[model samples]
Target: MHLDNNTNSEGQKREYCSNGASRGGAKIIKTFSSRNTTQNLGNNRFNNTSNIGAYENNPLIKSGRVSLDKTYNSRTNSKFNNMIPTTYETRDISIVFEEDRQNAKHYDMLEETDDDIIVTGTNCDTPICFKTWEDMELDPRLMENIKKSGYIKPRRIQAFSFPLITAGYDIKGQAETGSGKTAAFLLPIIDKMLKLKFVSMRRTPYALVITPTRELALQIHEQAKKFCLNTPYECAKLYGQLEKSSLNRELDGGCDILIGTPGKLKDFTKNLQINFSKLAFVVIDEADRLLEFNFANDVNEIINSPLCTPISKRQNLLFFATITKELERYSMDWMRKEVATIKNKRENEVNNKIHHNIINVQGLSKNKLVVDLLIDEQKQAEESDLSLRKTLVFVERKKVCNILALMLMNYGIKSASLNGDRLQKDREKAINEFRSGQITVLVATDVAARGIDIFDLDHVIVVDLPKDDFMTYVHRVGRTGRLKKGTATTFYNPETDYDFKDNLIEMLQNLGQDVPDFLQQ
Candidate 1:
């Protein structure tokens, strides 16, 4: 269902860069000087005002500087001009302060240790070798389908979970969002169901797949259809926002596989429109997300429905990117102890598929600064030959999202706002247009960030600084960087303290991304 909320009527807040410098061009430089200074005589050889470096035992200061000049080589280790004197100067200190605040939050979130703590699920520390479809002994036709889709090897999640799933064993698959968990369960389910001569009971879904949001449900349905193209396997999507009568007809005709969001699935079951009496396999995609406080009750009731449970103990597959303490308890209680738990390593995963960058601007005026960035991007897109089609800009609040959408439309950029406030139909239309290149820009709230999967997106803009949480930041950036190569530009006010920016940089480093120097101010 399209969730709607009150949009903020206030205009964008005006904020100036704490420092007059534009984020357009900046280079991070590392400078080191030889120790050849006499005591009592000044040894400073570079401008140390805005950024300073202290020497420890070795009587020379080295500083890393970021510059935007095309000629600026950040990778090169060089010395500052020695002839000039070095002195500490004051510039935009806001970014420095912001960094400190962010660092404090990061430290607070850590388990008060310098070591990696296993937060959830079993840590499979072994090196996971991804397997090819042939190696996995998947159905020949299915393997051909995977190849046609350009998927020669199974992703870590699929490689680990598919074998157990086909063996009729219940399993829990844990991996990050971009790890291809959907296909892990879909392939095995299709293979098993295609082996059957007939689908059981009219108006009953034999296999039920529940997702947290409609967009995600539709995405899974589309992917399943691609996999089952030439086969007898039939998959249909059932969600509330659609016409109930038409959906009921599909169920009555008999569907081999059914995919839907929690609320709609429960409604159909309650009305006795869909039956799961013959159901064999149950898959909960993004199980942890569906179990969030917002959708927990609905998801639980839907899972408990008769259609989801078989006459005897059935094959249950649960997939979640990250599981919290509460979700862990629920899983232990619901899933049998003997179930195979597959956790894949994501070290090799990179959006070789996505180009990521950050715009570190200095200032307290976040909203206004973001607007400026969006406008600049729009100009670049227009100047180009429609190359920047299918762009998504994220906002922190629903109100801000609406305002930004309005602002973009006012500037002749065909844009639509998507949030809980818009009707489901409106959201669907907007998403379709964005995908089709009808609308170039989509201003969205966080709701769209997690569930919606848009392919071949040109750009993803985080209009405001994401919370200190890296997972939240990852989800926002994940919107654009699908299988195809894409670009992500995150905006941040420069006044953030050095430590706060370092915390963010540290998180990105752990994720294996190169943090842009501008943000490290």
Candidate 2:
């Protein structure tokens, strides 16, 4: 049947176009038959006249019968005359009759199918990975904003995380960086708040999102603002760099969703007396990083404060690129006993879209090598008539980060340094400059660049391989190839990085890339 645009009883016009037969019509017909059989069996079981009279007299049952009668009458009165067609071919679009659309309200048109992603936990319903924005049935206003934001569909992480979160499940989600994790948690939370008609109150928020780094927190806050545009909801951000007076001003105006770092949020809860008793949702973004020893105390203080809602009363969400034992332990301590865990099945697999190249800088000056690489990249971009390719040069130490950035500038390559030693404003400036294409290269330390999302990043140059952890390499390379194809080159010092040679070779082989002869040796 060809699907066409139709207005439902609520006067909301929705397009139900699809190819071939209508899935909604088939489900409605099946449900109608099943319900009829159930009613027939109940009538037969209560055949006795006295029992029938008693059942009919019951107020609840009588009301239900009247409601069903009204619903049936309404359907018969619809444009289709009570007949729901399975297929109506008109320009190859399937049609759903008005009555059938109303009946299908309680039934979901999309069915859940198994895929590579894994979701498991106690008190978890069958996972429904929403394939499209329509499957989510979000607020029309929110959906409009989503379209304006230029998102055509939900990412895998968003697809799996939405249904569970909207249904009030505490979730621990693990996905790679740049996988739309922020929106996965934000959209559902905002939708629920809108449905509940939540109002922003002074110093009290309906949702709280905590992240480890200021950059990540700001990024999340920026996205939240975009999603909340034209809605009554208000969003506020707090971090070490933000002044107390600014935060106070924001709270005084009102806040519905508060995003911040652990230390700054803890300070507000203890001193400013910002109440979280009414918070319905609490999200810890980058959970694996936030649960580390340095952030443990502040996180504990913020979540455990009496001003905050108890763990049992609020829904908690933890999202991270990597899952660690410490994160598991923290979840056990703070999250409910029946928390839902959603993990991307391809988390361990390297992205084959990224072309991996290894350069053996055996006793040679690495600075000259990087200069040559950047110059070659620029030449290629110019030849292709494309913009200068954005690149991230990862260094192991802060000293190296600064030195390399300065050296690049001296060589007429626009470059900036991002490290822990820089002030918050400087860090923000560097990131902004890099994003705006003012600087082609961002020399960064792993700690400062973690969880920062940059779009259209073309290349990642690893000046030094992470000493021990293989996951660090994964994260560093993850910055590029975020939503498209990219490249990564790692300078390997056989003597300094000897311990990671085997692991690096295994990773390269798994990703379907050729292992260099030096590494294989």
Candidate 3:
């Protein structure tokens, strides 16, 4: 019999046969008193220290039953049969070793790699990236809710952000839209809220989320409700056009988490006797959009409200699809100077699964082109035995959005329009119809570009590209390709869009898409 060296669960070095042998049998054959320079298993054996580790750590081998060769069983070798327990079966040993090798390799990778996410800030103290929800040590009820929500594991952003936020450090995080940034901040904050006892005397909220748009505020509130299920926490949303009485009713009924837009939140602080002493968390979502000239003053006033918690006292979190130096500079005025920034290293890298195409509409009409594209998409879906394609057509102005919806309807295409000018109820109806597949196409302005999560979106058609901001173009196309493969087609007019051509060409090249000849000129 040929012998090979291996260690058991205990630190005892012993030699065993390559064919098969139990730990007790190995102990009897060769108990090493000192280190050996080399060892042999059989004529077919090879020397490799890696295999030794695999064999020593393999569960099957450690359980006192190493697989035996079928040839050994054929030979009525009484001595060999006696050494190996009959409980062990004759099976292919390579499969067992491969599994052990793969497991060890994966463990090593997990230990050695942190390149997937990039984090940086002033005096940044790095935070742990949890691989599982259990690693976060979340409340049992919260964990149950998370599982019920079908979140098996936290996304990369969530993995890194959870620990930082849970540790009560102000963080500025940037990730691509629809990358689960909401849940990253929400889960950790909810976990913390569950730990603190609710004070009966407290009148203000425990946490406040300020978003750029009303639709986004509603979406966040909806998601928060799911996580807060079966818990004592209550969520309320405030935005423009929400009846004052209803807003008061939500507040009077006791809201633990209040989510709202700047204008309405600013009004609430001025009109209502809301207390901010109990507020422990503050989150600014879509920080780039909220910092725009139109919303910036209101955002500043709301944050600086006398009743609001001092910047030093509360944990602050700012999330953005695209983080900029200007936005970061503005944030530092209100946020902690030492705020740690967690960013997805791959944020600028567009998904290769999304196909991007740009057409110069110098002479052709964009309206007819969009209609043709939608019709073609419908035909393709039917040919492929797939569901009807759901698409979002983006325009630059509310007028164009309304006009395009009407034009589509005139062309016998069932469509809806979502823009800021639309009534709140009307906007919600359009979103619901489009989301439910009752309407295949929804035309909107930049208002739908951020913080809106729609599943299974098949395509995005940018009928009117943003005037100057390339990131706005990114956000527009971001409407689709969320959880599935999608396509984005932009209608560019060189006459008016010449100034923005270079930006578009650069973005297309970065995404590995071909830039058109016209744009090259």
lDDT of 1 by residue, 380-410 (tens): 6567544445778887775556545544443
Q: Which residue pairs collide in model 3, if any?
A: none
lDDT by residue for model 3 (1-521), tens: 33445453335433222222212234223222232212221112323342344345545446643331111212243222111111212222233233223333223323222226777763556657898888999999888877665565677788988888877789998887656788888898888878875653344888889999988987788778778878888887888876778878877766688899988888778875567667788888998888763677787787777778888888888988777787867788768766878886776545444566666556444565566556555555567686556789998876556545644543345677777766676676677666556667889988898878775676788888787888888888887765544677677787888887888777767766656566777
Error of 2 at 486 (Å): 1.1
For each candidate, give its TM-score against the true structure: 0.69, 0.76, 0.75
- Compared with the true structure, what per-residue lDDT tens digits does model 2 show for residues 330-392? 888778887888887776555555667676666545655576556655665577686557899
Predicted model with the maximum TM-score: 2
Q: What's the C-alpha lDDT at position 133 in model 2?
A: 94
| lDDT (C-alpha, whole model) for all candidates | 0.58, 0.68, 0.67
Candidate 1 stretches with Cα past 4 Å from truth are 1-130, 198-200, 306-312, 346-356, 360-371, 378-386, 465-469, 493-503, 511-521
User: What lDDT score is found at residue 392 in candidate 1?
Assistant: 88
Q: What lDDT is obtained when candidate 1 is compared to the true structure? A: 0.58
Question: Which 10-residue window of candidate 3 scores lowest in summed lDDT?
Answer: 81-90
